[model samples]
Target: MFSATLRSRAASSASLQSRSLATAAAPSSSSSGEPLTHYRITLRRSAIALPMNIKGTLAALGIHRRLQTVFHRHTPDIAGKILTIKELVTVENVPESAVRTKWEQRQERKASRGYEVAGSKLGAEP
Candidate 1:
């Protein structure tokens, strides 16, 4: 019984990898034609020296390093991949418009510059 269970788990993980790749390559909306949702997956932990499979999965998810986030359209294959590396990352659903580019994310992280004064450096003296 243990062997059977192990075999099944291995087979499922293998198939999941393939399916995740396919989904990440090209995504399709449902039959209803409504826009598909997206998942913003961010790598919270590094896959360094862990295992080749885990590293590959991060690459497949478009996450290269820690705290790097990537958005992917919602799909079963992507979901499977997320599940495989769930411990190393975080996931959230967001509309397409909510997705921000790398530059945008950086800008958002930066502390806002305080209001600038047009006439500064020289104060009125009586």
Candidate 2:
């Protein structure tokens, strides 16, 4: 049991290291450094003691936890939601091109599998 905890701690540290490397390799700014087109929203604070309307505002924005990030296009509805919970989150405008889906962000954080598979025969027709 002690060994398992150590292994998990090691793995988590490795992942943190790799995530830092990924950010260092490519900066997100555009070549021209022009203004971004979409809002890069991050939940910076929790709504624990806030009113139900405030909590609902966070949910409407797709924020699930403290520090959780979600992006959205610049629209009236989104702007209103952001304004409603302006105290709880931080917002930045990022280029539409820079926005990434949850899956894409996951791929960035994932460590590459060390081994490559040449082919699989399990799905072969009989």
Cα deviation of 37, candidate 1, in Å? 0.8
Per-residue lDDT tens digits for candidate 1, residues 63-115, read 88898989898889999999989889877666677678889999999997997
Residue 121 C-alpha lDDT in model 1: 52
Alpha carbon lDDT at 40, candidate 2:
75
Candidate number achieving the greatest lDDT relative to the actual structure = 2
- Tens-digit lDDT track for model 2 on 4-25? 9999899777767777454332
Task: Evaluate model 1: give its TM-score.
Answer: 0.58
Which pairs clash (backbone N, Cα, C closer than 3 Å) in model 2?
Answer: none
Task: Give candidate 1 misplaced runs (Cα > 4 Å).
Answer: 1-36, 115-126
The residue-level lDDT of candidate 1 at 9 comes to: 100
- Per-residue error at 8 for model 1, in Å? 47
lDDT score of residue 43 within candidate 1: 90
Clashes of 2: 0
On the 0 to 100 scale, the lDDT of residue 14 in model 1 is 70
**RMSD of each candidate?**
15.0, 11.6
C-alpha lDDT of all candidate models, in order: 0.79, 0.79
